[model samples]
Target: MATDPVTDWATDFDHTDDRWAADPFPIWDDLRSACPVARTERYGGAWLPTTHADVTAIANDSEHFTSRSVIVSGHRPPVELAPAGIAPPISADPPFHAASRRMLLPVFSPQRIAELEPSTRAYCNELLDGVRGRDVVDAAVDYAQHIPVRVIARMLGLPDEDGDRFRGFVEGVIEAVADPREERIETFLGLLHYLSPYIEARQADPQDDVISLLLASDIDGEPLDPLMVVRTIGLLLIAGIDTTWSAIGASIWHLAATPADRRRLVDEPALIPTAIEELLRAYAPVTMARLVKQDVTLAGCPMEAEDWVLLPFPAANRDPAFFDRADEVLLDRSPNRHAAFGLGMHRCAGSHLARMELRVALEEWLRAFPDFSLADGDAVRWSGGQVRGPRTPPVRVAP
Candidate 1:
């Protein structure tokens, strides 16, 4: 994906560009002051809202914006997919979104997520145990990337060995956002083919996992459509893996680079949770996309129907208008009102699960390796497109 260098951040912005993928904070900062709602011809005409006010307004406005296809690609999903979009709840709107969301709520509630802490911690430690004697390790590959994939797999009753296949699906859906449209569609179809059997098996013999839960669930006394169940499973597998791993990797990268932050966590493990919030604010991984339902003027910019509107929650989280010292990561920052999870109807349902993984990931990493730093600052690699974080964050683990 060799994209032309961004000549102007306001006029023609490409999220898949290497520059945005590497460090989008400065670009967002520059646009926030110059152009709050930047326009771009890429991705079949899209808008990037950098300010908190604009992002929140668009996220909360379902009438003007459609969640039909949350991922901004060269081609969007058909209009019929509205109400219950590609991946329910996250990509759904109004009437259908609530019921679809409620189905998974109990599984990710605070109590449920709390119950998984011990296992998540054990998994993190297990990852550390693999690299115990090594002087260097790719935290993203060796640790951060594995936790969520394993957890989500167990929850969905997918085999742990299928982690590699699941990661391939994640990369196809998320990292390859700028690929050819035909290729992208094929990737999605492949995911459906892979998941159909497992869904069928769950239907035959129900289990305690999410797939069985969804299979057993119904809307207004009607069983869910098989396709919808597969789509939801795909959603859990894809969305669940990339976002949290990115957050975990980026958090570890931050600690490795900034020793002060690392030491603080190593000494006062109590601050890990607070630090996780600030880290999520500073290095928010997910950015959602919405399709313009009708012609609308936002922040003096005219957006036509079917246009792509990128709700950059990460940008909104770092907006100066929204928070004091927004660019700086304050571990003890009180009243942190960040849109890292998102805002309004489409907020992440797995937020509690994400927090638990992140908190436990950091806590265990610190406990195992009290001190660590980047092996080579230039070696860090970030995934392109809406989801942003280090893909190869190699760090030197202390003895």
Candidate 2:
């Protein structure tokens, strides 16, 4: 609880602290009860919304709150990467966002995602097969991390060999808050360099990949801008990899620790889907940002133009006002309107693909280790800022 000498508001909202990183819910629980919209002095000064309604309101009222820099630290694109600072639909607002999303809609449409489900399932089984005989497995690194990276690589049309590096770049970009500036920018440059050739190849020889789809998309009367294509791919790469991976990892971590939940899923596989949703609600793990575009009073808190506000969707998922037993994980909880994938216009474009990946990953993991628990000696360590999940979740599988 580091106090902001200047604001004196987020006196207890130090996101970089080890305690907060280890377990933020307790801190968020306090804030939701005390101040639903608490101000934080960290990350160059910003406001955080904890309650489900307030977070939802901030997400929905984009007119008052812009989506230019979706990070509380604020988006500062290196001159070294691409000409454009941040990519669209994620970085752009309203009409521009709508137009950009229209171009990307084809790539993430329900039908397109449905077509990829079987292959995603096969990939999951293949990943699990490599570690089935082992007594110990890292549900985070070994399983959860692998699913989304490969799924995203296939969509980006990157060669199979590039998946590992793809995952690294995603981590580097998403974890930039606490990471070194040089390292993070270098990762951005790395992504650009890797995509440069692919973007060029797509222009010359368009194929079935997302690049080609973007190249073919039209805005108004003409083809979508080529620069926009590159920017959109960049956004997709970051969004596609981390958001689902964190969700999947959190789900696995929860099940590994709770035998009753694990047994229920294993015994009645039919409940897996709803169970997944319940886990998603209970362990939702994304916190995005929006720049204040106009003066607004949200839940009595004053916000000014250009000021940044964080939309911690995970906190919103746990808001007692919206979900019953909000703090507890209900394996088959229903009527859940969780914002795990966000809400309103900027709702996750890759949600269908993400859902398919999570479903497949969980199903295969359970099949491999019907009854698993966190390794006795080691403990689950969580990462904070933007996304939260176990980075090193060691699960023991009994023979």
Candidate 3:
């Protein structure tokens, strides 16, 4: 379905619009100054909180805004899905949210993430190996997009050959936000059908994978239902791949455009970690949604019950009041408290893994192609909807 172009950003903003997909910083800056909390009639009425203060407050105050339907679309999930939303932990609220989240923490712990680094690094090089001889390659497609897909597939004990299918699934779930509710539901149903076989296999033959782990996990000594396992795995597949790849692709796009930053990172390998944090701040990919639990006024906006509130973490990361030089990317900026991984209880559980993939991705890419630039700046394409990142960041490397 086609959406009308946004005539006025303040009054009628659509996150899935092209203007937003290309570059949203200026829009966010304008909103922060003019209307910190911009309301729109789109998506059955939604609110966008651009300031760090408002975004943070809304994220923490789950009582007023339920995490039930984290994605705002033409159709909202049934209210009964609350407390344990479509996806557990992330979509689950409060008491149920805590237990659901705690069960998965051990798998994503620092130690566990570190254990996966060597393999992750190996995979990075393996991807780079494919485009070694090419003069021009899409850093987003040739490299960034495949890393998390393969990693997440391995973690879930799925076939690596399913990468393309996984990307399609990610696109359907994340990028097709503005599509009709029926289409959105169909997309989810397709994913569930695709995952049904794998879920059954894991149940019959448990393995050292995330699917098996969730199957064994229980909340309050009550085993999670099969549908819950499917939903969580679906979350892992969609969230784990899309957000990390977008971050990696956007980071690569930045390094390709900014010669000074690229050269510095190439020269100072030790600065990659700090640089990655700064990159995440500047190009955070994920923007979560919340369904209003009840009527409330936040930052002067009168938000009604069931209104969709978009938590634009990228916008919050750029709020001047929250961080010094909020607009600029300082590779060595310390004490950086950016909401790249989100904020409050719903914070990303796989953050450690994301950082590791991004760091290794950059390190390996820079090591291989130390000098590269955008093949054509105009050709670069960014995905629309809640998750924003370059979909086609083509780069030209030295022959």
TM-score of 1: 0.99
How many steric clashes does model 1 contain? 0
TM for candidate 2 is 0.92
Instruction: Assess each prediction's global lDDT (C-alpha) against the native.
Output: 0.92, 0.78, 0.93
Worst 10-residue lDDT window for candidate 3 reads 173-182
Error of 3 at 133 (Å): 1.6
lDDT string, candidate 2, 1-399, tens digits: 233333333443645455665777887888888777888656655788888888888888867977766755534433233212377787777666787777777788889999988888898888888888888898878888878888888888877777678777766776556555676667777888878888889989998899888888877777877776777788888788778888898888888888899999999999998888888887877778877777899888888776678888888888888888889998888877888888878888887887888888899889878988988535777766677778888899987
* Model 3 residue pairs with clashes: none
Q: What is candidate 1's lDDT per residue for 227-285, written digit by digit as tens?
A: 99999899999999999999999999999999999999888999888889999999999
> Each model's TM-score?
0.99, 0.92, 0.99
Of 2 and 3, the candidate ranking higher by lDDT: 3
Native RMSD of candidate 1 (Å)? 0.9
lDDT of 3 by residue, 1-399 (tens): 669999888899999999999999999999999988888999899999999999999999988999987887878888999899998879999889999999889989999999999999999999899899999999988999999998999988889999999999998888888777788889999999999898899889999999899999999999989899999999999999999999999999999999999999999999999999999999999999999999999977889998999999999999999999999999999988899999999999999999999999999999999999999999999999989999999899987
Cα lDDT for residue 128, candidate 3: 91
- Each model's RMSD to truth, in Å? 0.9, 3.3, 0.8
User: Candidate 1: lDDT of 65?
Assistant: 98
Clashing residue pairs for model 2 = 1-12, 3-11
